[model samples]
Target: MAETIDDKIKNYRTAPFDARFPNVNQTRNCYQNYLDFHRCNKALAAKDQDVSPCEWYHRVYKSLCPISWVQKWDEQIENGSFAGKI
Candidate 1:
């Protein structure tokens, strides 16, 4: 079965590396991810921009440094593959 939001959140929380910056330690990465996530959420929601949390999340996660998964995530989001899974 597909994973739920709770599952994703739990994974993110307990993940070995931070979602924001995957190369960094868990604590730092988690904090960074949280900040970026909130920032993206606010920007998208408040600014009425096409940018979604998924976009930022994906970019940061897949970046060469820290979190490179973000890019992979962006692809997923763009393709409607990561919907509700994040």
Candidate 2:
């Protein structure tokens, strides 16, 4: 296992196997990572902390989610119509 968060980030190639998302469908995994990316960024930014760690979630979601879906969700987030709380 990685010794630190930086190692985890550096080692990332695709979404790692998650016990919470064991099924074949990765839709939930993708969506959760998408939300996690935004939440991590927002929370860390508020504390004046580096937000680079959020990139892990961004990479994971980008790998698993459809581009069209990401676009739509991004648009909805901008328009305040996104259903998922970020």
Candidate of highest TM-score: 2
TM-score of 1: 0.34
Off by over 4 Å in 2: 1-3
RMSD of 1: 12.6
Best-fitting candidate, scored by lDDT: 2
Model 1, runs deviating above 4 Å: 1-24, 51-86
Q: How accurate is candidate 2 locally (lDDT)?
A: 0.93
lDDT by residue (1-86, candidate 2, tens digit) is 53898887787798889999999999999999999999999999999999998899999999999999999999999999999987
| Overall lDDT per candidate, in order of appearance | 0.51, 0.93
Q: Please give, for residues 1-62, the per-residue lDDT of candidate 1 as tens digits.
A: 89975566445532344344555345455445544664677677777776543544544433
TM-score of each: 0.34, 0.89
